[model samples]
Target: MDTRCNDITTRNKNEALCNACLIPIKENMRFYKCTYECNFVLHEWCTRLTTELKDYKIERDQLRHFSHRHPLTLVYLQQPNHNADDEDEEEKEKEKEEDFVEEDHHGGQCEMCNKEIWSFHLCYYYCKSCNYSLHKFCAELPMTQQNHPSHPSHILTLSNLVQSRNNFYFRSTDGTWKCSLCNLMWKNIYNYHCSICNFNMDIICATMSEQKINHPSHPHRLERMSGPIVSGCLACGNKHEGEFFQCTNCPTFRINLDCALLPTKLLIQNHTNGTYTHSHPLTLAYSYPHSEIISKYYPFCRVCDGKFYSHLWIYKCDKCRYYVHVDCATSKREPFMSIFLHESLGKTFKNYKEDEHPNLLHCPFPDEDDNLLKHHMSNQMEFISKQHDGEMLNHPSHQHPLIFFNEQTSVDKKMVSLHDPMKRIQLLCDGCVKPITTVPFYMCCQYVDEQCCFVLHEWCAKLPSQVQDYAGHPEHPLSLLPKIPGKFFGVFKCSICELQSNGFVYGCITCEFYVDINCAFIPKEITHDAHPDHLLLRVKPSTNLSKRYCKACQYSVRYSELVFHCPSCDFYIHVQCALLLPKLIKHKCDKHPLSLRYEPVENHISQYFCEICEDEFDPWEWFYHCTTCAQSMHAACGPLILQCEQATYAYDQQSVYRFLNVKFGGTLEIKGHSHRLAFVQGLERDGKCSECDTKLQYEMIFKCLECEFALDYKCASSFVS
Candidate 1:
């Protein structure tokens, strides 16, 4: 026999070789022959032997039945009887009927019995000789199972539980026996049992095969249990009780029988390499930077890119990288996963149109006729021309016929006017209405005479020399003063106008008054209510005893001696007072309560008032008031008051009276009364006034012929100046 492909080896020549048992074949023997080696053959029984049988050294004779303590033997063929009655048709019919009845009673072929039977019946197959049988399906089962390496003793067995105990059962607190696999409890009776181990499985667990099974909750097949029941169910975190599928090598790991068969890898929409960038992992049980611990741990699923609020998570990435919540990343469409473009790529360059370009010259070449350049030059030249024109008029007085002359020709005697040869000469400028200096004088041809020694600028002689109402002094008619002074001259003073004569001066010859060309046309009726007591008087300095301070503002007079003064009250004022315009005025003490009132009083204190907000008072106080209503105020309240009433008023007689009545504790004698009034010291015993509760320092004592009354300084000075 050839031993190369045979399980059993033998040395022989011309022997019909057994391929499996490796023995010489006999003429009447039953054996299996290999197609590749026609001479090779195997015994029929040897080919049917189980793989476990090979390890036991048993003799060929022992294969009959001694190992099983039974009379079982291998039979080659059964002997036949030849009798006429044995082939009876009726008897054969009866036998066939009996076989049919038996098959019907046993349902379909019993898997353990390995025989054909009827269908739709419940009965176990049994052997008549030894009473050993199995269900047809079980009879065909292999001796050992695959994928269940840990449990070697698993075997097929018939379930014989009572009808009441056959249902699914689980343990409960009601003192009942239960089946852990089916989750149903039984209260009354014992039923089917396991012969080995303390674990008593239900009919369901015993019959369930080790194969993938479908469950409604998961989208995968669930495998059967092969080892100890897991304590934690990976799907729900509850204590696992029933049979479950778990990998022993993975600590504390157990998946639902359903989850065990799911595809290991998933392709998620916004995840890469089974991880979501949106959900970076931190250390398990790690504290947050602010010392907060996440109570319910969850990880973002890469597959769905959504947060899975579960405690079991896989964290094996570097710490520096950021991870977004899977749900957040998915909703954002994973914009960070864009393909990077190289900087050198022309596609990255942006193109801009000429109109959109920020460069000054998009065309690169210079064009003299460019519209922008022409516009710029035109604007610049226009500005320069205006500046030059402004410079042409240095002084308003010189605007007539001014001419630049060299100093050499300035002292020419011919430039002197003949009308006033001995009179002091005064020069006039054609340009800015100002007097010309010792430069050469341009004379009018008509006025120039060598022997007459008279000369004047032609333009200066023709220019207008008189003006009507100028600024605030309007009543007086103004005329130009002659260039040469008359016989009586001590610095040419205009007696009526009260202004020093300079260059061409306007004068009211009827009043013997003169004013500079600028002040000649002052307006007579100023719109200011501050000076409403009397019309603003434009007059030069005079010996009038009443003209003291400026009537408008009460400021001391200096250069412009011709000022506005009120003849009625002997008040003088500056012209600028009439022009003051303030937005809002306030006082320090009563900011919100008081406002300026501008109205003329019959006996005005100091002249001038804020007319818009008609407030009148001593001009010494800063005057400002609202222009809406009638309210008088003091400038001292500006520090305290923020808002006030509208109207303004000029200083009234009451203010002047108040000022005069203020006492400095000095002795005062009434002009008409004969007796002298003296300030007497008050009692120093901290006695307060009955009326005002103020500590009185000095009391006034009035000594009269019939009566005497002691009064405070305030009361004593009230009746006197």
Candidate 2:
């Protein structure tokens, strides 16, 4: 061991000493031991400054030290731990006994905590004094090493060998690092550095064992890389060429270090024992796609408080399914049962007399007993039992006295009995069979079969009455009519909801405006495939009508008199097409359902791909996508296309150009015509034909040098064109 200081100092005395701990050294004339970089020298006495030879035991050629309880071995770099010559009979017998002891002591104290060890590792040790124990590898570490898995070529220096610095090489101003170990950047910290690549590893991360590590995400132990690098990270789905945890049993199972450390279970403070569980004080949950029981019961972890659809968990009760994190359970130091119980029962038992209450009659001691708290708790349990008898009083929604109905009852002549005196009455809605509690009941006069069902709330019975200007016919104010009209009807068409007027029809008194009650509330702005710029609007057909088609569902304008039109794009659709609500459109590309969004800004670039044609979308086009799953589809190619009976042609490219020109209300000249033809400015592209002065527009076009066949600006500028 070299004991030398590079700085100028005297040859003898305390001046020439180790920087860590200073001690006087004697001068040596002939013999000298100096640092490689300097000429300073020290005597042998100065080298070994401390006389602390803490006894350490060696097992299987590995030594366990007290200072740091990691496993270590004394071996020269030139000499390997095991010799090339195979072990003889005597050595083999000794090795077998060592292996047996290690295997049988699996349940022994953890070398670090001196507690019973349930998990295993590469090495172990026990401290006799403090009963504190740890692995030998965790004690003595090498000063430097090369070709480590994290860094293939750079040598990692130990903390004791390097001088400390206030600022870390990798951390930002706040001591955070962008290194893979932390995943996120920090402001300040000590870190290992690779000068060549400028890569820095934190001290804790640098010492991480290159072996199986216990993580909360997976049940099986995750091992260090013993095979080829994985193609992608399991958590973020990003391609990577780095160290990752892989399950030995499953080839496909892989996860990054950051994702593996995420907390498994959560205990919600607000939801604990509120709705999910009554017996347990805490509520627990986990992540999705783990265990079938978690998804089936929808158990929430009490630690994180997040609802868990799927993940492995240890719960309080097998019946209530109150799950919690195993680590959280172990670290829980304080009792929460008392606080939770007091909060739940404090208000209900505020006035109950301890002496007179029969539920409190079974108290284990006299009224003045010292264990009054325990007796009070016993009485609270009795109150809870009585409250669980499936009885409720004066629920806010109910008007008359109501009782829990044993069976569905008929509405014919059943009078309320005064002796039972119903505390509440729950009437079922006529439209949706869900029960509605109230006093005054509206009975429907008409019967469906022999059952004269006549009990419902006033709002439920009159729900079919309200209506307004429906469909594209503004002249007709649609209202629910008692009977269907016989005038000018082949098949009754609804003015509100575009569906056939099969049920109760809402008809206009002045004109032939009629629609179903459901159709009256059809929203105006809706997503459509035909016009990309804006949602289609329901309107009466214009007198100057060119051929038009439904932007959504891609159907022909069968009912030409009335249609859904987009003024911005000059797009039109039949009234029936406009009646289709935006929510109904479903795209196959996404697993979750999609919804329609109405965007007013036309400048926003369309960044989605179409599910139907598998093509990029023009920003100006109106579209629909599953909000949750992100599956997108052209409004024209919505799922309702199958229901359309008529045959439809592919969307006309020329019509799009015409619509654009009409919107701009501009004119331009085209080439190869005797007179300059009036054309609207459409989609435009660069490069004029050499033969013609006309600028190129569409991808494919006819060119003539003599005639100069240039496209009009409107025709070339249109996105669809």
Candidate 3:
């Protein structure tokens, strides 16, 4: 076939379907067509590239497909599943009998793509040695394509040159090709060039539907755009991209590409429940209703690890009753989300039934466009289990099913005995390496029976099989591993947190990266009294900076553990350091309840010292620095910060310290003493202090004007300090 008489590639302007690759022809692109009444054209590049590439490992001339194991040979014509070369008469008869009986064996399915073959007439690739088969589109579509679903009726001829033919093209980019559907320009590497219709698509979006899509954020379907519009995205209040998702039901609803394709659900590896399995899955959703009450709840998104803005989409799991931000699952701000072409099937084209596709997310080696890794850990409230069968737990993280026990006196497999005093021992957890004193841990009975000694914390056993974090490695999704190999083979320390945890960890085998449960599973944003001005952001402490002190405990904070820090205020604290003190609590020493104050204000009486523990307190650090009682206490000394009822009287700075701030004379005329005495800051010489009844130093003192006899602050008839 000859489309041109001469080899003048620049002279040819005609564009048509390339008969060899079945793709559109672009202007200035070389092609050949037959003049003998038959209109056939083949791209010049198609002639140079072999139909079957050389296999690096397997047989010669083997097509190395990403999805299949066997080498395939490209065929211009469609081939049947059964090879015509099978020559045995009996075997041929058997094959024909099987082919007729097996309705699915007629090459009605593209094995490599796992997609239905609409028709057998299309060109395909065939494996002569096996039953493997692939569509021609699947084999070649990985690199280049034209005439995509968007502007399906039009031929999107390749536009290698950035300059458009006509100046009438709206919203054109200087150095990039512009997409008609999205109304945005993209780098040549991420997009397919089209000059004829001035239509283009990003590399990933090229194969997707140009019409409608189902995003996890909105309940309604989204329609594709063909032109630029001035609208802000509902998910993120940004007006950057032109192509976006518009609601079918509402005109006001518009989502940018970044928001529309953002992952909404993920499995929560860190859960509130410390049991063998999390009772329910966690989802990203609004913690509060659409009202001003959201501020009262202090809503924060767990997925994106960000503070919540009013009226934004979040991933929510009904069962877990939790919400996370969609952006947290993937770091792809400019992702090519494939539209749901076959909406009649409910889920998008890439998504399948959850039960049938469990392994899709857990696969070690996944395709670049694989949807399973898109939101692997996004929980969808699919937690279904009988409470009665909790003793026989079925956890996703463990290979073998777990069995939990409630406070057993005797141990399984004679590992330890709780009955014998001589054999009493503290069983350290395999996951956290903390004492496993609490009941209800899921132990691997199969392994224990095999004498391997395998066990996990209840919460550790219930961790999600995978985690999805956008700011992490972009190439491969992180997978959960039971343990890592240490210098001692089985024993290992956490790469993050730096604790010697023999527990569950999220790891990327490809990158040789690992993070422990406490470090990996912590929420993205923490709303607490520790730093109330702005929500504390979870981040790895920088090694370049010196170790920071925890604001709560006044202890030096290490960079080994992930800490919460406010960039604006320069406030930093470790997760473990903040958990020490609670909001409010009551102690046996005092009848009234005490509240924790991060920045304890020093007053006239004492320098914010703990009355209970009798220790000096750090006014800037967290403590029960009482402004009302003019007394402070240590949260650690009391050790219990249980919630209690508030007093009838509310704390008023003027009213609470009215008596303490009263005017005092420099010399007090005591009724018991004969004369007026001078008030002093403290005693210069060794003397008794009534508060502690010991040798006084810096203790307030008052002396009689007539005698050398002195009285400490507490013993003085009319005290002054």
Please report the candidate that would top TM-score against the real structure: 2
**What's the TM for model 1?**
0.17
Which is superior by lDDT, 1 or 3?
A: 3
TM of each candidate vs. truth: 0.17, 0.32, 0.29
Q: Each candidate: RMSD to true structure?
A: 40.1, 25.2, 27.8
What tens-digit string does per-residue lDDT give for candidate 2 at 54-130? Answer: 34345655454423334444322121133225888778646543433211123244332223332334344444445
Rank the models by TM-score, top first: 2, 3, 1
Whole-model lDDT, candidate 1? Answer: 0.35
Model 1 stretches astray by more than 4 angstroms: 1-254, 257-310, 319-721
Write down the RMSD of candidate 1 (Cα, Å): 40.1
Give the number of the best model, judged by lDDT: 3
lDDT of 3 by residue, 379-466 (tens): 5323422233656766554567666755664456355321111132324445543334455566665744654344555555555667
Q: Please, what are the lDDT tens digits per residue for candidate 1 over residues 678-719?
A: 443443332444334555432223323223323444544455
Predictions in order: lDDT: 0.35, 0.39, 0.46
TM-score-best of 1 and 2: 2
Question: Backbone clashes per model, in order?
Answer: 101, 67, 27
